[model samples]
Target: MIEPVELIGLAAGFLTAFSTVPQSIRIIRVRQAAAVSAGTYFMLLGSYILWLVYGIIQGAISIIFWNVIGIILGAAVLIMKLFIWKD
Candidate 1:
């Protein structure tokens, strides 16, 4: 069973991981990424990768899981920005 504090951490992770989803969806829906900053997404992706590596080293499941999700979401935005969406 997850303790209350752990559950709070997991919830926070989940929210943060999925926070990019709305942006991704909007980009896809509009088929435009004129306002999206590829540089920002690149930085976010790098941070997520570093966090993932640290989580792996620390054997932190929540960190690993959430960072993986964050990576995927961030990648989706980047892909749309770089390849699919156009101004």
Candidate 2:
């Protein structure tokens, strides 16, 4: 039996992860990320890392899954802001 509650988690995770996409798109489109702060993304990445750690300790699959996605997207934005997209 599929747990319906899991869908909620999946949905939430997807939303949270993809919520960063607009900024990413903007950065890509402009080819500059001067407005984005490296510190903010670093802090966000660190926070998500902690979230993943906590999820691991608690054996919460949804939390771990979401945090992984968050980390990947956050890293993408951070990388773009710091290295690739920034002029």
Winner by lDDT: 1
Report per-prediction Cα RMSD to one decimal.
1.2, 2.0
Error of 1 at 2 (Å): 2.6
Per-prediction TM-score, please? Answer: 0.91, 0.81
lDDT of 1 by residue, 1-87 (tens): 769998889889998899899999899788789999999999999989999999999999889999999999999999999988755
Residue pairs clashing, model 2: none
Model 1's alpha-carbon lDDT is: 0.92
Candidate 1 lDDT score at position 27? 90
Tens digit of per-residue lDDT, candidate 2, span 47-80: 8899899999999988898899899998999988
Candidate 1, pairs of clashing residues: none
lDDT of 2 at 48: 87
